[model samples]
Target: MFASVFVIALGLCYCSRASSQSSLGLPRLFGPSEALVKTAIEMNCELLTFPEDEPILLQLFREGNHSRLFAEYTSLEGEVADLPVYVQPYHEGNLECVARAQNNSLIEPTVSNIHYLKVIEPVKGAEIEVRSGSVDLFEGNMLELRCKLKAGNHVSYKWLLNGRLVSQSLLHDDRLLINRTTSQDSGSYRCVASNSFNQTDFFTSNSTEVVITVREPVKGAEIEVRSGSVDLFEGNMLELRCKLKAGNHVSYKWLLNGQLVSQSLLHDDRLLINRTTSQDSGSYRCVASNSFNQTDFFTSNSTEVVITVREPVKGAEIEVRSGSVDLFEGNMLELRCKLKAGNHVSYKWLLNGQLVSQSLLHDDRLLINRTTSQDSGSYRCVASNSFNQTDFFTSNSTEVVITVRDLVSTPNISFTVLKEDFQNYSAVVTCRSTRGTPPVTFSLYNSTEVIASVTVEEQFATFKVPLILGQDLGFLQCQARNGDNATYSEKIPLEVVPVGGPVKMPYTYDSGENYDVIGVTFYCKAEKGTHPRYQWFLNGTLLDDRGSFYYVDHQPPEMAMLMLSVGDSSAGTYHCEVSDSFDNTTAISSRRLYLDKHTLNRLPVWVVAVVFGSFTFLILLVSVCCGLGVVFRRRHYGEKSLLDFEMERMTPVYYGKLDLSHYNEDTDVVNAARWGEVDQASLDSVDEWPQIEEEKKTLEDEPAEEP
Candidate 1:
């Protein structure tokens, strides 16, 4: 019993030892997988397999070379190894831990798994660029700013305006675009570039700030005279200023009598005259303008100001009938010379420094019944006293440039497509009027809505517009207007060509071949675009239009089909080239396999399921039939054996005869007789029965045996 007990204890000890050995897990090196260049990082090697406090050796293997890395022990419990510092290039490699002995010798040099450390470059030296070429722009123009970097990898960018984050709607990958810019958009812009390292920390750098200044178009200019009175005496100083309601970076110029005054006498926005004489008593105006746009300057002219000097004929100003010198053909023209403080004044007109005829002059006015282009010239009015013919004191008003322009004829409209890119399709529409004057206002229209309008000094005007792919061309129109007369050009009849996108050629099994395949149909479609045309290529060879083995069917706009015969050498990599009718953008479909004629026919899923189900049911039915037959046969054989045994051991019984004629064939013999007849007498006379029987037998024995 003691020996048995000892054997049982030994068995328990062996089992416990095996359980502890399986429970201990192997040590692993764990830390971040990535690090930035020139940065130091740490890694830990813990959960050591060996249960000892011996020192560990950390090693790195990189570029077919192995080197020992610096590691130290941690203060925490169960400390294994801690990497002291990780330098780039030298320390970036596969890292592992080796168990060491007390004498600094390797205990086990083999490692289970290795952890890779990848070094990534940091983001640096980011800069911003104004793609629109200038940081200063006018209102209602496009503003595009792009971000650039000197060196970066896997970088993303964000924009800030005046120390606030910009909206995502105006930002693209590295660009920011503001359409129809406003004055509120003027601010200092900055770009921030960032990238991720170690999958947890981020490195970012800021770009230099770019300042933007948005100016408004000059409008509603008025001239203000700073002098005490407009009617200045001779030798009095004159001060005239130009003020703007809305404008920026404005410069002013003084216009005296419809002629430019020298800039030498202008001071900023003010015009100064040290001494004023009767010659300065004419229409005085100021023109306010700014060069804030890349193409043109926005200019505005203030209303005419009549300055009068203390004289007999003062403030001689010319006034046209319509407050404008511009007139249309076959229109009445009138010019009147007026004075601010004068009496008995008679007016005379001069064209191009020449005196006008008396037939066109009337008292203090000049009239023309019908004007023509011949009437265009610089005209001025001279006011004089009628009473003094011998000593005529005359004063000339400012020169007025009268122009009689012909009515604007029907404008001709035409367009040229600038670009056909899918995202930014654009066109330039030109509107021209050969019979009209310069500085004509041209308006471009789509249906009834005006797309854009411009007033150019030349006879033709051009408008840049974004084009939609499927819009009707008849809706594009242009109009030229001068004064109150306007004329529209004929509607455009040309359509915008559709841009083509990526092509996808997907082949599907339509029908199965019985003996020989007719063909296989491949459908090619564009992911997004319009008016795509397709061409088929087999093994890098373009298919002919009248090929005997292939046929092309164009479905128009977006889809096309190619049918290739299966029996020919058409079993190569097949692809389709889709091109846009509007541009040179062409896309090729990915190469796909073409099945041969000898390929096995793929049956439908439902047919295969039906065949499998029928076979399974047939097997089940046969199994049930065989089992029933065996059971029935076994029962029949067992019953036959029992019956034969019973017949082998038979017993016979005798009965007395009674009423045999009344017996029924269907009834048993025992049940057919009545026992109460002569059965008892026959039974009691059994002793004499042998003699009677012997006598009866002797009487019938000879006949019964011999017969």
Candidate 2:
């Protein structure tokens, strides 16, 4: 019995130990099978194999595969190994499996919580750019691509063309070079930097493009002429174009048939000869080159142009028909240009040698109205036919010297108003020719006779006279005379009047009578004058120009009133004044004006309207609410039985109670008739009517008030 007990006790102890080792509840395989141990290690299981059994035992590794990114796994050793402070163990053939978190990406479990292992997937942030030495791309240019602003280990650069892999670095390099670019190389390119652990799991940069254009190298070039209708006429405009259609870095030159023309005389592939005459008839062509490449150009000469000239006009000379004359500044002169011999001729006038006027009066005459000293020049008239417009020809005209001598201008009269009023004012008059000869004589005259006279070698003269203010001013003027001519000024009209303004109103604001409320009523007055202005003063201080309560007058400005709308603050002793700067004078009121404060604050129209409207609305709302309350309670009482409705004690319980105890079926008709208040109509012909019992409705204390 003792031996059997011992065996049973031993089996129980062995079972407990085995259960603790088999964490996944699987039976532990105690055999050291090589295949099982290798497979478990490959799947990232933490295996505790004997040092002599492991290949070298110098390093401990979590289960993983070897790759180009193996170097990066070392940098995560400390972080991943420090986590998942617990492990579950199992036996797999020759190895024991210890399962724990192999990466740092995990929620740390509490002591009472079940722990878990989470594997972190590798990720990288990447960007790309062109290499610094790479300029804008062109054919035959060297180009490079670089991966920049990236974070990852074991990163490899890949360049794609049109979404397909084109250029790749040999090692873990981040740059790719293109030896030379061709037109066929132009494409949408993309550079990608990857962690290399997973190629498809990558970030792609923005697309960078390469544009390649072909520029042909320079060779020999030729010139061509494309002038249509070069059969030359005297006035025909011609052109010769030297063209080089094929070459890089090309240059051009122009030539006259076989003569090499200086480049200084030509403007880029053109040679222009204006007003071509008999001397201009020649063979013309241009020479072309690619001087930028230092290459001489070739020319095909069958395209030469020979020009022939002709004359369609005869004897186009100009003659001066009018002799020159000396004249005063204000005097007029006419100069004429006559065509000596030409058909269908036109005329132009010249001062010295420069062309002056192309449009002229009838008979080619130039009129100088109010001629000035600047008009004194050598005048000539030019005669030309239409044929001479484009063909070169010498314009012929004899010069004429226009001698403008000792010129006198019209007189201008200015005045200063002196004292005196009513009908006339004492004033001084200045008469002068603004531009004239020095020895000028000015005579001041009225309609009847000359009032004053002065002869001075200066530009102006003055005289004093008592002038009338009205119609007589139009009768005075001045006349000025030089050696050759005399001139009279337009009449001078003098306006003279005494300055005036309002002195006082017949009534004063001091009157105790309440005549008007603020600006509601006002006294009307029209301040009439020539250019009248006004100023107002209140309480010995100038008021601001305008304010909220000031009156707006639809009438003219001078006919408006000065308003005191709300007079409490505005009321004061006031003065009215005006000043005229024409004669530098001022006018003030003869007597003082006064305003007094009213008994109450004047309400604006809008405020009064708002107050009245609100009171009316509130009265209407209260009346509507009270009437509606009675109507609704009566309706509710009629819909319910005498005892069905609930009522508070303070409210009369009898108010909603319908007294139906005395009701009878036959009395319905009689009740309706009495309730309708029917009046009896006379039935004269009828003798007997149906005898009906009347319903009596006695007023008992006007009934109890309802609701």
Candidate 3:
């Protein structure tokens, strides 16, 4: 029995050791498997491994009723290793765990890491509420309410009305909205908020009510006048009154021709016109206003008025029948007068400022009975009305003269040509008397002197003389006489032409293209004679001077002609004008020069080509130069080379130079050499000293070059 017991105990110890070595809660190395280790206590532990096998060992102890352990192992290569593990209660009970490694030694459990787990209590009462217990909302108005927690988590909100959940899913937003609403949508509202950790429900609210109204006003008032039209004679008095329909305690105003008229008392609704005249005719209206409002006013149609007065009438004017007269015995003469204006007027005839006939009437007809040379005097008329009187008389002088023809003479008349050798022209000869009664005798004299005689009825007269080419152009004189006296006229000279100078042409062709030759510019010279006149003709139709010329043709290299008759004053050169009526004209001389066709077509072509070719060449040259510049620049510098050169040359160089004199001193030289050698070795001993010396010299030389 002792032998058997020893074997069992040994077996039990072996099983505990094997179990600690193989137990790891690290799950399986491959495939899905649950490799869980059940321990009697909770513990912290991690698996750590290195490139080589090292044995892990641990130590354990207890402080203040808690147990802890630190474990370490050393490999055969002298490398130290550690394994940490911890043991504590798994739930509310005490526990124990052991750690073991692949080297087959038991390890005391050590605490390496700790973790905590927490538990919370469940939620309590949660709810939501509006500001008032029952919310009364207007249909179109915005609804704003807050949901709060009486207990539990900060809650969320929803809304409900009439025990059926109103759709407040969209009320996730803070505000509830209803737009363009009608009267039916007003109701109660509520919200709720909650969370998983709490219990209890919360609520809040108040009631809302609303009403609406509509708008409008009364109708318009009316106004009327009492009297219609007021017409009054000049200097007469007139009055008018106005009235209103729906009359009330109101104010009244008077108006004339639609304009308000002022009076001592405007409150009375009456208009009075005093001392009325033709100027008083107009349409009249009135207006009435009250504290409530004013009535619209309109006037009657206009009225017409007429006025009358009396005026005076006046009589006639008188004058003699002739300019001058000679007083002689038994001469028949008469004086007369006539009326001018006005009605019911009469006249009394007056002679030499005295009344002659009292029976003259307003008809103004008057006459002298008979006349002798002594009856010559001023005559006039006296005009009168029953209401007014006046006198209109001729001037206080006579306008008559007379002569008595007692004896008469047979007058001698003759004509002489002033110039000798009258050729193809006519002349005028005059016959006159120096002293004679009207009706004197005149006679004509030629080579035989006194060849014809005639009775002269006036003091002087003229007769035409026909010239015989050679003999009639000579000095000529006239003889004139009355029955009592005779006299001779001064001599006049006569001239005649040689019958044929160039026959005058009388048309001016204005300068133009159609009249480009000589014939168009020809004009006639005047014939030197009396009553010389001008006439223009184009192909035998008489042309007016004001509008005769026109451009019959505008083609160049053509000759045109016009016809004319010359007057005495038109004796100068005339030019032909040819034009296109664009006010573009070629003078007679210019048209002749330009009619050569060789010049017109070639001139414009040469000018246009020269101008256009110059512009095209200028544009092409500019484009070619710009393209060449871009190409040359790209070929000279590639992208990488351009960037490197910019970095090298464009960076600024500093001029911080060390003083050689200070370095040459003993102490500074020792210190500088030490640091310099160290820096040189660090920079791989590049030749930075030469570059620094060159930059120092450049900076030192810059100031000397400035002057």
**Largest lDDT belongs to which candidate?**
1
- How high is the lDDT of residue 685 in model 3? 19
lDDT of 3: 0.37
- Stretches > 4 Å off in candidate 3: 1-437, 440-451, 456-466, 470-472, 479-490, 503-523, 526-535, 539-707
- Model 2 misplaced regions, further than 4 Å: 1-321, 325-395, 398-443, 451-475, 478-495, 501-576, 582-585, 589-614, 617-621, 624-707
* Local accuracy of candidate 3 as per-residue lDDT tens digits, 1-707: 43454433432222111123333222111111111112111222233422123232322222222443322223222122222222122212222222233353433333322223111122334334343222433234434444444342233445555444556543644334444333344444455443331133233222232222111111132323322223323433356555444333345665556666677524366656533445556655555554322233322222322222122233345554532344333333444554555546555665565666554322554443344434445565555543323221211122222333422323334433333232333455666544445666665555436645677567656566666532435565556655345556555444433222233333332222332221223333332322222333343344454433322322222233333222212222233433212112221121111111111111234655898798667556655665565455457665546435334323222221221321233564343211001111211212353443454355446543221
lDDT of 1 at 430: 91
Alpha carbon deviation, residue 633, candidate 3 (Å): 13
After aligning candidate 1 to the native by TM-score, how far in Å is the CA of 393 from where it should be?
Answer: 25
lDDT, candidate 1, 501-581, per-residue tens: 456666643443342334577878876554566777887887876577778888866688888765536656577777665
Better of 1 and 3 by lDDT: 1
Error of 3 at 621 (Å): 12
- In order of listing, the candidates' clash counts read 0, 0, 70
lDDT of the candidates, in the order given? 0.67, 0.46, 0.37
